[model samples]
Target: MEISGYIALAVMGITLGLVGAGGSILTIPILVYLLQVPITLATSYSLVVVGSTAFIGLLRYRDHILFRKAILFLIPSALGVFAARRFIVPTLSNILGHLLLGQVLVILLIIFMGIAGYFMIKRPILDIQNHSHKKQNIKKSKVVLIGLALGIIMGLLGAGGGFLIIPTLVLLMHFAMREAVATSLFIIAINSFIGFVTNQSQFIASDWGNLKKYLTPSLLGMLIGLYIVKFINGEILKKSFGYFIWVVGIAILTKEFIL
Candidate 1:
């Protein structure tokens, strides 16, 4: 079962490589449940592993870079990430009320997975023919607000908030799914790095026992997944991944809350 769990992480890597968001969503579960890593340390480890993997994804999708738009999101997100990891995560206690913090985090993850699942499954509602004007209507002010919110979620949950950003990219920025996903990789990398640096001191001190056992396979899997994505048509894969997300979400809820 332990070995199977480790093997299953290849899917996590590929998902992150493809989406720039789901890797950490799956990482925490594998580390904490399968490998028996503690929840708090698993959160920190997820940042390192997912950030590293997604950085490589960003490079693969570099041509998709849209600095003019990417920067509009990255700056405010960076600040939010730094503050959350530096201040909030450190101060958090082991328990909130009667429940373990880990329990709370898992529940939150399940909620997000459900929402993200919907995002993946839905067809694009906005049209691209007049997208230039739609893009213009997306105010920088609103982007900054959303970016900050996303950053805080990443810092607190150790999951990339791509589901939130990708829609903005497609509907408001008028990017296709692939471009939005690639741009999201850039955002995740920027946000993850800020959070990682804020916790650098403790990160250096923590006993990240056999973390490489997880990272090596994840990176390898991401590379494979990236290649596979090129051959797939867009909407087909989108709805497919959406259903996959629902399965994962339901599985997590059953394991954490019910089982």
Candidate 2:
């Protein structure tokens, strides 16, 4: 590939390392704007790449991840992903296909990223100090609800769902931020895989050359990111990452709106 392509791949890796979900948000833009892949194809490709990377990361952190809780969350999310992929995304994409659909997808991507960015910056005050007893009482229900909600978003938008999952775990479920991040990666991996499987037919029809080009570099970057997670102060970095997301989202939105 060219220098620019390598640069973009490196950027993607660094972004994922610094902030878990940014890779999904940036994947479509890189494929479409930089590599000239069609938007629909780009979205599918992004899901495959992000899902694969998240799966690898989750595997590395499996020992630390809370499996019982993760499974509880995954069940509802799996159901949600099935429902959305079977009923929602195809319907919406069909309706919007003619009206600059690529632009519309880009706009939606930006909106989601912007919301994620804002949440990152705000860093909701989590009260985990004395909620141990309360957590046991309501944790299952909260995990299921969050999983369903996150799954719907993932199915609809091709997102990895880390943005929603991490916050939900940390703020409402009262998990430590680090554990939440680890858990979110697992959830994102599962949901993204399910969502991609739901759209397998369409993907098979598309030209997937760019995705091939992306695999090695993206995986290398993800490995680097996983390694970095061990040493970083995630909370502070997450806040700064939010600012970065805001800038990228606005820039993408502006480009779509104006040109």
Tens digit of per-residue lDDT, candidate 2, span 155-232: 666677677777677666766766877788888887778877887776552346656777667778888877787688
Clashing residue pairs, candidate 1?
none
Kindly list the per-residue Cα lDDT of model 1 for residues 1-259, writing each as its tens digit: 7797678778788776655555556777777778787777777777777787888888988898787878878888888888778877656552353246667677777787778778767755345425444546676688788888878777877777777777777666677666787898888877877777778677542355565677788888889878887676746665777788788778878877688
TM-scores of all candidate predictions against the true structure: 0.86, 0.83
Cα distance off (Å), candidate 1, residue 132: 12
CA shift at 75, candidate 2, in angstroms? 2.1
Best by lDDT: 1
